[model samples]
Target: MRFSLRSCLASLLLAAGCSAHALAPRSPGDLCGFTEGRTVLLGNLVFMMAGKTTIQDGHNEAYVKQLYWVDLNTTFNVEGAIPPNVLHSTDIPSSAPYESGGAFFAAGNTVFIYAGLMGNSRYDWMWSYNAKDGTWSRAQVDGGKLNVDHRFAGLSAVAPESNLSFFTGGWDKPITGTVVFNATDAADTKWTNVTRVEGDDAVGSPRIANGGMDYLRLGKQGVLVAFGGYDISKNGTNQTETDHDLRPMDKINVFDIDSSTWYEIEATGEIPEARSAFCTAVSAAPDDSSFQVHMYGGRSRFRENATSYDDLYILTVPSFRWIRAPTTGLIPWTEDGVGRDSHKCVSWKDGEMVVFGGTPRKDDKVQKGCSRNYPPIRVLDTSKLQWQKQFERTTKYTVPRIVSDIVGGDETGKATLKEPEGGWANSKLQSIFSQTVARRPDITEVPIPPEPTDPPKSTIPGEEPNSSNTGAIAGGVVGGVLGVAIIAGIIFFLRRRNKKKNDNSFAAATPAAPPAPPSMYPDQQQIPMDSKDDAYMQLPGELHGQTAVPPRYELDSPIQSRNRTVFELDSSARER
Candidate 1:
């Protein structure tokens, strides 16, 4: 098996417990402003509260039980009890099955809580709480018609520059649209249904069980994004693949408010495996480039004692990658505490995503709430990706087992609960457990770069020339013609020259022929006489450079005479 370089490195990191999910301790510098396992700091004091969710509306702190105003910049001593006044009676919507309700926003001093689901019934009324006057007023649904019967599955609100509130996502029933309401001007309450995505693949299916969460403004450059929720059919019992379709959606459907269209982005990497009824929070660093969306503990696999994970993940925008966050060495809960689900998550200052107020494990036989429960307030820092236990210092509250419609804190500049500006109440926050009136801090917003509409240009190398290139036909023909002509000229010259120097010259250079042939018979042949009789002698230079020659044999000797006589006798016999 060939392992990639990346896989090897990942394995090494995991082995060393240096990975994001591990409980290894981080360095001191990594802790920055907050320490590991520290309480959540609101303005100056740290809160340890459970069972109740909180948000800021201006100078007023709104919870399920009461509404109060506090100077967020100062510390509240037990002696100096801040004035607490009840907003909703314990019996009014009395233990409304809908634990999730209340939407908080500061519009020129007025904080409004619109129709949140009261138990199973969808509340048609809007309740307005004024921070400046410290009073509550009921808001009218301008169209004279509101869906009171069908509880909204998910609701999102954004305060555009116009100070108008736009809510979208039809929940509970199959309402495929959005509504725009102007709380500042009562008459401007108008519900305009936006277009829904067309298909059996619509994300709006199995609406009842799944809750909604997202950013209000949908555009390419929009800072907000929406994600996971519970789906009854999909996450519910007797769920066939087709019967339940919403528990874990692979596609993160985004609504481009600017284009008024829906875009589905596919998620990849070591992302949290498919699960629903989870929570998300954002952490914006001093340098905006470090901004991230963090997903924390959730129920992925349902069981009788199915533990909610303490795993933390951060989605880095712009690059669009999910990175495991570094942890500050803290455990999720004591070994004895029970695992949790259906919780509220919010971000605190110093780069922490504080999750608080969730319900207990649901039993199949008894479906209302779980018997074994957990601490109400648990703060998780995405930067650290660990849970800090400060339940002792915060409010002591138990599980409120329902989705909170409004979860935002005061962001206004004032000191009164007048502006729950930053914390859980930022416009970007989906629904949470409660609402309040403290100044909310400004969450660092990330602006997405515009998508490129044009296609990328090719970067491949083009064809080039080397030594072999030439005009093939012309070059070959020209070379062949020149070669033939040169050969012909040489051949013709050689033939002419050879004819001029022919055989006539050969005869002149020949020696004279012998005068006559010798006669064949010995009697007819003339024999030369001895030198004394003929008187023939050698002349000077007659034979060039010749010396006097001696006769080859002696005239008479025993062996020679005998050999010659025998040879003569043999010749005479042959002749006869």
Candidate 2:
């Protein structure tokens, strides 16, 4: 066939355009704006809730109460073209316009958001986002004007089975007790306090903020696990002082729901360093016999001078053993630019853990950069221990003014960005970003049962439950069976050959070298006894000159001044 040069050139140009399009990095902004926000996973979508942003409000320092979602089915690819409508914001009418360090938990199709800092004060209100209908409504509870002390960075976990949500530790005061909220009973709904058992008088009980907590089902019962948060008890009663010595809670605490008791877990193996503002998610093994708490990215010490970590660790429950996940793919600081703290993470059924935005730490320096405007979304495959960049924001698009009391008012005012010249137009983008408004589903508000008046018996056993033991035993059994099968096959072959031939014709069998000692599991390797002790250890001579002296501010203070108080508050302490 005769072909014109003009046609051939056109064909080449078309192929080049297609190739470029195929190779282009998928923009996370195609789905939503870059935000350092909290995320909730429902079905195949991730709801990126309220967070601090630099783009929309002009000042670049305001917290926006905006809602965005990423269709996980589309954004799961590491290398692919930008998916349409993968990222979009919802315009649900929210009473408050600021939320940071708040508790976000989902029960059924409804997402429950508890108190978070709205402006400079902690908000005392509670709101729910119905994902099925994409509507936000204020929850009406019966407790005599619910008065929880406004606090931020507190930890919360919901027990749908018990129809209760538990809040613990915040910036206000050392919350000596776990705050229990009954959402089922609107008429009688109030915050109830669960007092913690006494610990050492000097050390006290855990009172922390910016910590991570999750509810895990152990066998038939549910347990609430708290890990890694900032404790400011040593800073005295002044809440606004920046000089307060904040430290990370190194110990792991577990609250047994059935028994209504708290106990500290002594996890062995390679426990993670003490840190706070990290994110955690629970994932059960395929067999559903045991689960793992996947923790990632938090500040190492005091928030101001803290070091960000990109490390991933898993604490196997029931066994209470820690395992440092050896991950591949993107290295946190190196590949992603810098490590992050205060990020949000959620786990899916396919063993994939998704981590959203947080503040990023600077490279080899204590000062973290404020360039987290459009932070990329990273996904970790827990089963394989590999990391992948799912989606990232590519363009700077204007979002509607996030009207909130925290920012004084509509900070964006009448200002708007000109729409990009090509692709999706401004109206199309707005349409894609329009919030879904469906009919709110009926929520059964069952009143929480009154607590027993008499002193309760202890439900905690003397020994810790070893849920992982069964899995280990099963592995050993399979290995043993395979070994036996190989040995039997060898013996049968030798016997059959001996029965059919003369023995003198055969050469002597060389003795097999003794099997090499089996390698130890990654957890079996020797690790530092204390997570903090290594911080003071001297650097080896080879690295002595390269490392800078660690920053010390309150080095001259008394040891007591360096220690924070831990509290177990009574129900009477609730804000009135």
TM-score of each: 0.45, 0.56
Tens digits of per-residue lDDT for model 2, 130-196: 5544567776554333334345566777665545678777667534577777655433445666775
lDDT of 1 by residue, 312-394 (tens): 66553323345555456455444443334445455544345555444333221101211111333455534335455321112
Error of 1 at 26 (Å): 32
User: In model 2, what is the error at residue 442, expressed in angstroms?
Assistant: 22
Q: CA shift at 217, candidate 2, in angstroms?
A: 0.7
Q: How close is candidate 1 to the true structure, as a TM-score?
A: 0.45
Error of 2 at 86 (Å): 2.0
lDDT of 2 at 432: 23
Return the top candidate by lDDT. Answer: 2
